[model samples]
Target: MAVIANAKVETLPEPWSGAIRSGRHQLITDKPESFGGQDQGLAPYDLICSGLISCTMITLRMYAQHKGIDLGAFQVEADFCTNKEGREWIERRVHFQSPPDEALQHKVLDICSKTPVTKTLLRSLEINTQLV
Candidate 1:
């Protein structure tokens, strides 16, 4: 497995505005003005969802290509909600421009659940923090 350890984020003067760096790419993150941010870019939850969605789609595409399966255009929508119980649930809807067979659809669904981000989210996280 490839490791990504160089990702970093720096806070800007604006509240909740962060400059994120990953390799040669950079992105901005901020919350809505109602949450005391400038609303410049995706919030934390949106970034998480984006990771999961991107991973899922990439995994499926690789699998289909490797297996010589003709998976046409597709789209995925994911929603995240947390309740009083502190439980977070992510609901995802996937649609294909040309629907595949039931077997292929099931295979794709299975692969989506196994995406790196999806698996990581489902498993317990062990974070060790330190101040340099």
Candidate 2:
């Protein structure tokens, strides 16, 4: 399989904080104060949600543009959830500044389910970690 993306995370001076480098961009990840972090940035789960949310938005926008559809402004929100059986999942919602028609709305919903990140999360994934 081809590697689509790669990231490097290094520990920071602050407790529970990490410096992340991916592609040409850099960002920080940290837990909230309640979790003993200084709340300097997004937590681990938040970053996961962010990836899904961003991929959804970008995929939708590209589809709309290619179809010559005006979607206007939109936002995607995702929340990590754990059920009683301890199974983890995510609840994602999309809101448009100006709502589209019923047909378009249905199409958008379908597109959301087919985003790259969405598919990745839905399927079984094997993460292999090793020390170099």
Candidate 3:
């Protein structure tokens, strides 16, 4: 597959903090003070969850517009969890300010499960890293 996106991260003088650059966007990632770093920004797992949540919402909105459905306002919440077996997973919840009917609700949920980020997370992924 071709490269769909790219990101570069560099460490800061502060321990456990990284400056991230992707396209025209820039952000920081850091461990919390409890993890021995200044709580400067979201940690890695939080960024993952943020991606999933945002992608799901955007996909839903796009689908709704295409189908002429009014979702009004909605919120997507996601949490990262580890089971007793040490397997990690994400739990997601969606709430609509103007709830749709049962059939539409089911359809929206089905679409959520198929969002781009959700599909990526569901499948096994390979990451190739190298030092330049």
Candidate 4:
């Protein structure tokens, strides 16, 4: 059984700090001074959205390749935001830009749903956090 899990622990204060890792990729993060960070790498919110977008595009490409579908010309663009519905994240808008096709729009959307990040976000999650 293959399991995918990410762990990030706060490693700094003020600007905030954390080390996040997934698969073979590991990264440290902080916010900009404007947001309490020292103008480090990507912002936390950007990281979150980018993770999802990457998974969606990768999954789409993988699925297309498997079915002998040509994806050399495939393209995708994704955007998202954090919006709490009363108290929880109940609504999200994932905009995508791919080759327009009347018959393929549904197929592409279906493939996107199978992305790991999509599944993870749509499913319940358990996060343990505390001040360091």
Write model 1 residue lDDT over 1-132, tens digit each, in one string: 566547789999998999999999999999999998999999999988888888888888999899998798998878888999999989887889999998888888899888888999999988889999
Question: Each candidate: how many clashes?
Answer: 0, 0, 0, 3
Point to the candidate with the largest lDDT.
2
Which has the higher lDDT value, candidate number 2 or candidate number 4?
2
Q: Write the per-residue lDDT of candidate 4 for residues 8-127, one digit (tens) a residue.
A: 545755457666666678777877788767766667666777778777777877777888876555444544544566443423234444454656678877777777887888898887
lDDT of 3: 0.94
Which parts of model 2 have CA positions greater than 4 angstroms off?
Answer: none
Model 1, TM vs. native = 0.93
Q: After superposition, how far is residue 132 of candidate 4 from its true place, in Å?
A: 11
Candidate 3 lDDT over residue span 74-99, tens digit each: 89999999988999999999999988
Candidate 1: what lDDT?
Answer: 0.89
Q: If both were scored by TM-score, which would come out higher, candidate 1 or candidate 4? A: 1
CA lDDT, candidate 4, residue 130: 89
Off by over 4 Å in 3: none
Error of 4 at 31 (Å): 0.8
* Poorest 10 consecutive residues by lDDT, candidate 4: 87-96
Per-residue lDDT value at 80 in model 3: 97
lDDT of 1 at 43: 95
